[model samples]
Target: MRPNPDAQSPGPCEAAPARKGGERPSRRLLLGLLGSTGMLAALPAAGQAPTSAPKASFGYADVVERARQLGERPFDADAARIPESLSQLSYDSYREIRLRRDKAFWRDGGSDFRLLPFHLGFLHDKPVQLHSVANGVALPIPFTTALFEYGKVPVPKGLSPSLGFAGFAVTTTLNHPTVQDEVISFLGASYFRLIGRGQRYGLSARSLALDIGGAYPEEFPFMRALWLEEPAPDATELVIYALLDSPSVAGAYRYVVRPGPTTHVDVTATIVPRKVIERIGIAPLTSMFQAGEGDLAQRSDFRPEIHDSDGLMMQAGSGEWIWRPLRNPRSLRIASFVDENPRGFGLMQRDRDFGNYQDLEAHYHARPGYWVEPQGEWGKGRIELIEIPTDNEAFDNIGACWTPEAPLPVGEASEFRYSLSALSTTGPLHPYAQTQHSFAGSDLEDGHAQGQGSKRFIVDFAGGDLAYHLGDPARVELAVSVTAGSVMTRILQPNPAAGGFRAIVDASLPDGQTGEMRIFLRARGRTLSETWTSSWTAPAAAAPPQPSE
Candidate 1:
């Protein structure tokens, strides 16, 4: 089955709030990667097959060098390579061609990890070359019909034996030491997703994003080839090397993935541009933001919320924590949070209550929040958040990436290294109070102090000292700011039920205009919470809410 774009199950554990329990590849051989001269020493021929003896040597240095050389030449769009039969297969028929579990690489060899390669069909007709490496030699994974269990679909008699893999899934005893479970997958373009000890695959990470949410058409880079390094018998971490190619750039990527309570992937990539890229994105992330507490009126579903992520959180280099609640906007919107050197940023799913989603099958609460922590100073870049209008939860319309202020120099290599954390919750990292939930609504009551067109923002903060020092919450003060419009009232009160504090901001909007608002809690001149930010846009016209199905 195609990876569910919006609904991947987390783990078996029930999610707790931030204040509570919620507070949470391979290598090819030498010649292919390193080129001819840089090959490692040849191994002694001992296997039965003399004709297939180890060829040239390969390593990460060779892959980077190859990428640099490839970028110097014009990109070759290798289309028409997929067989017509495979391309014409329907989605259902494609799903029928499943990889046989028993035939997985290393499964029967008593290794800690197993690899399953995907068949080329349906939307993934562009085959990606996959290689397995052991003892410094690389061997291309050969394609064979026997590798798959083709349910009822008939395989063409004359299909080429040279067909390559589309992508692959790696499995390990992630859930339990004795049980094999899918830990991560690399499929389709440059998209890949992973799960921690308890995380289900929710969002995906891209090796690089170019021209996303820009004026011109976007470019999608694909994993041209991949090398899977043979893991030791009892290895805990897996290594993968990939060559990425697109019209504008070519790249070499290395991922050191370790699955744990918080699965961490240490990513290192070097990008060599064929052309100057004005809008390049580093460590981009893709997720869904169909509707959340901030824009629940847009959704007519029975679930209180339907989203893979609810907010964008950034820890700026200035030590300020910024939280931007995601929205299902009426129009495509791009928000940029400029910074000189960002500490970190991520698309977070803060609300973990199952009641909020009520999706028994989807299990949105278990979806992990993906955080990007730069390994070094990335000097002068903006965290770009792109929100696209969507009518349903199926589309992954929310994107966050780091965009460098200056364009990438053509023919020169640029590198970025970062650690990706698949977090169950951000509470454990932040020492101060943080936003757990936020909601917005029109203040329509006539007797209310605020009149029509005035909006009320109710934000909840939990964890840290919020529950301790805020016992008399009246002592807490709400720090509020607005780019436009006027704030009518701002108040902070203790939420005994949540064991936290709630801050409310009431503001009157200008006719047919939009305004930016920011709010946070401070007690006795000390910052008590992350700054909660949102954009208020006046609807062109109001429509009656549709009844839930």
Candidate 2:
């Protein structure tokens, strides 16, 4: 689902969190992607059957040229390149149609991976060309029923065969011979999500984001064509070169995916902008945040929480590790953390307990936390977190990425390179206990809302040295402060059942003004726990509103 907009902001993902061992398309594509029927019908009526030499295929180098040439003109996306039959299917019907395992191309080629084209529908209507590199020549992967079995939907015969691919999914048969595991997928816009072993899909990674969180209409770039490097028959690794295009920029991307206990993917890119761009988000993540225990707004659901990611985890370049809980807000809010060559950042689903969510079909605990690490020194810039107001959890409301310290000059080419991992944990898989949950309400003796300027913040700390540090945690004072507000009361107590400590920090603002609060465990001022920071704005009656930090 989505994050709760009203909860406090979480920090950037820290370390390299990978799977710690704990954690569809459809139809009318029944035809091909490239329009082959038109070419066949145009051929002369000579008695000779319509026969032709291999058609020219595009390659990785071609994508570079396209980006360079695009810089001379405006960017344009051609989603219509796909046929009508493929783009009209619904979600349920699309899932029913799938590529047959036995008919996968290069079945006898000694390859461990299979290439399945995405069935166009819903958000993935853009068509992209797919190619296979084998004997030095790149060949097109054409569409045909041999690859998939259309369930109940009737086939529309003579529907000009267009043999193009919407996108591609790479599968690995490491553990199972008859079944293939979907390891990576590149579909819809410049968005391609991957996973490490044991990690379930949770967040998404995008090639580039332009004008994001801006007052103007947002721009979404799409991968128009992909040149898949032909894998050796015994190849366990795969490389995919892609062509990214949109109204603002054109770029090239290369992804090398290696699957295992901690599956990793190395991503390299060279971008050529069509024009000036002030806000360019690299390694952006999209997730849903609906509500949390802190949220007093009651709904019909009985579950305690509902969200895809809990907060943003970031390790600043200065070695300041921070965790900001996510929130589903009532208005648009953007948190920008200016930094130079920041260590790493990610949107993490840190609260991994089955009891946190009761939905069996939607396994919230299995979702992965993807973290991005820079390969080289990226110059001065800030990691930005954009939280959009959403009523339902289905829509992705959280966007986090690196916003360059300097703007990309107009009509000039810019280049950036970064390596990222899609993992399950928060990084280093450390044994450090963390905040299991954050709850809030008016501080009263018996859980009743009290009209006190001292707002209560209930925080649950789990994992660290809870057994030894529980009762009367000496030196563990509640360090609480609020900008545009004041701290009225504070207290830290023991939760024997939770086997952890709880802090009830009660604070308030002088008036209805924007307030920022930070709280965590600190003993002898040595920073006993990860810092929790958040920004909140008072209601109109409180004061002039300012978005959270």
For model 1 the TM-score comes to 0.86
**Model 1 misplacement above 4 A:** 1-57, 443-453, 539-549
For model 1, how does the per-residue alpha-carbon lDDT over 1-549 read when each residue is reduced to its tens digit? Answer: 122211111111112112123321001110011111111111111232322665456678877998998898888876426788887766456546655544567654567787777777655666787777777786777666766667879965566545676777787888898986677777767878778887666777888888888876677788888988888887889889999998999999999999888888999999999988888889998887777876657776788788888889999989899899988877888888889889999998888889888988668898889999998889997999988877656457788999999998889998899999888888876788888888887753442332225788899988778778655767788899988878888887888777788888888765467888999888889998899998886534446699999
Any idea what lDDT model 1 has? 0.74
Worst 10 residues of 2 by lDDT: 35-44
The lDDT for every candidate, in the order shown, is: 0.74, 0.64
lDDT of 2 by residue, 1-549 (tens): 121111111111111111224212111121111111110101111122112443346455666776777666765545445556655655445545555544554455578876656655433567676666655555555545444556775553453335455576677773466666667777666666676665565566778877778766567777776877768977878888887787777788888888766667787776787777888888778776777657657333877777778889887888666778888877788988889988888888887787877867557676777777877887899999888766555456778989887777665656666777766667364344467678766433442222223356778776666656765566566667666566666778877777767877766653345677887776665655666778765443434579999
Best of the candidates, TM-score = 1
C-alpha TM-scores of all predictions: 0.86, 0.80
